[model samples]
Target: MRPLEGHHAIVTGGGSGIGAAIARTLAAQGARLTLVGRRAAPIEALAHALHGTAVTADVTDRAQVDAALAHARAANGPVTILINNAGAAESTPFARIDAAGWRRMMAINLDAVFHCTQAALPDLRAASAGRIVTVASTAALKGYAYTAAYAAAKHGVLGLTRSLALELAGTSVTVNAVCPGFTDTAIVAEAAANIARISGRTPDAARAELARFNPQGRLITPEEVAASVLWLCLPDSGSITGQAIAIAGGEVM
Candidate 1:
């Protein structure tokens, strides 16, 4: 059965990778979608194909997020499921990261989750199957070199997820995080490129180095992460909350 049929769902970063995969998965489950992204082309294309609405907004900006969701609601009704999937990564030594860069990381990876979750909480609380799933990174659970800022923000994401989950434990809303490791996505591709550039390694070798982080010796798939998010949104997963489920192929226990 299409468990989410008619449910209003908002998926940020719905343009590609994990976000797009989640959007498609939720759409297939019969959820009405609001595809949120900074770019217009990709999300619009995906939304068109999925028969969903597409809204553009800088998710890191609270006012923009609010305005964008206002439009999304007009198109798809109140949001019941919020997927905080919009995020970026930067690889830099801790000493090299400036204040601006650190703040940018926090804004995109941490504060943006705050804005979107806050904007959708009321509707989620009202829905019979409210779900808030944030696409965090395995970095949240563990540490990595040249990624202090990114790791810090992601770790903050888990803290937010758990704290919110506790505060809303008695409600219908469930807050959780999916932490992926070296996912086969544009973000990973960028990381590979950065590694290649810095270490003068071949792109293939750099990617392989990342894959080696996982005990499974392969990169995680976007669909794999999406599947976990879909499961959490299901009615049967109601009892699960305040949890950070790792999709890192044992990269993080």
Candidate 2:
């Protein structure tokens, strides 16, 4: 039998990149998957491929999240694992970030986490092995240039992970965050574009510049991040809670 044979896993941002990778990994281990994303086409296609259910909803909105989760639970069972992987990052100079920019970052990166965790808390608390793994970034651990708003929001989510872990310590729930650095995702492409615009460098050059942060001279893969997330949801990892597991190649350490 698969390790996650009886688990019900809900993955937000599950249409692509790390979220999709995590969903695939969990489904492989026998967990029922509910792919949640803002885009219907992508999530629906991926869900079809993986034989999972797709529910399109902007996680930053509470009403959308609640309705989405209800649909998910009705399709699958209650959530035993919740992956908070839906987020966005805007790279702008501190002085250029207006109130709208800062609020947008917080709403997507931090507030969405709060809403999802609360919405899934009941089922997670009742599950025999409840796991919540958030896909945070290394920016949460350290500061990033021209990404003050993004970093601040990431740090807030990491703080939430820690606090919620403690609050749920008495229960069967475990909350953790995975911090990935310079991942090879569309977000990284956006960052590279920002760098190219600022430094007047080629996009490839900007990507190389971003990859230099890793001593390995390469960006982390979504599958690498997904593997760690999958491990955290395994039954053996029940004791590993309230931790920020960095998937950076020595960039964080």
Candidate 3:
């Protein structure tokens, strides 16, 4: 039998990027999925393609997250695997980082993870053996030059993951974080655009410059991050709790 046969999983931000990749990979591995995202179109499209359930909700809102979790549980059974992949990122000089921007990043990146994982506990406990994975960033382990707020929020995610892993230590549950560096996702496009506007380089040049941080001289792919996530959910990964596995192509060290 497939490793994840009959398992139920919930993937937030499953509409696109790393989240989409994770949802697809898990489904292929025999995990039934419930995909959650703010937008309906992409999530629905992905659900149709992957034969998963889709729920559109703004993860930053607690009530919305609760509703989404309920919908997911109804469709896919108790969430034996929770992928807290919904997040936002922004980069700005430390001196220019405004409170509003800071809070927005925190709400989507840190607060959303808190709310989603808390809301999923009942279902996770029902499963008895569950996996909770958060998509953090290399910035969480290290620091980023112009991404102070984003880095802080990701760091908060890792802290939360470690704490939850300890809290549920005796139980048949695992909590971990996946920290990716310069991945080829829409976030990279946004960053490239922002950098191009600020530094007067073409967006293509900005992307290349960012990719230089990865020792491989290339950007990490969403599929690669998804694969690492799948590995953490395997039966053999029961002992790998409270870990922050970096998918940064050796950039964080």
RMSD of each: 0.8, 0.9, 1.0
Per-candidate Cα lDDT values, in order, are 0.94, 0.94, 0.92
> Between candidates 2 and 3, which one is better according to TM-score?
2
Model 1 reaches what TM-score against the true structure? Answer: 0.98
Using TM-score, rank the candidates from best to worst.
Answer: 1, 2, 3
- Tell me how many residue pairs clash in candidate 2: 0
Please write out the lDDT profile of model 2 over residues 16-56, one tens digit for every residue: 98999999999999999999998999899999999999998
Model 1: lDDT equals: 0.94
Residue 8, model 1, lDDT: 92
Which pairs of residues collide in candidate 2? none
Q: In angstroms, how far off is 229's CA in candidate 1?
A: 0.5
Worst 10-residue lDDT window for candidate 1 reads 244-253
Q: What is the Cα-based lDDT of residue 245 in candidate 1?
A: 95
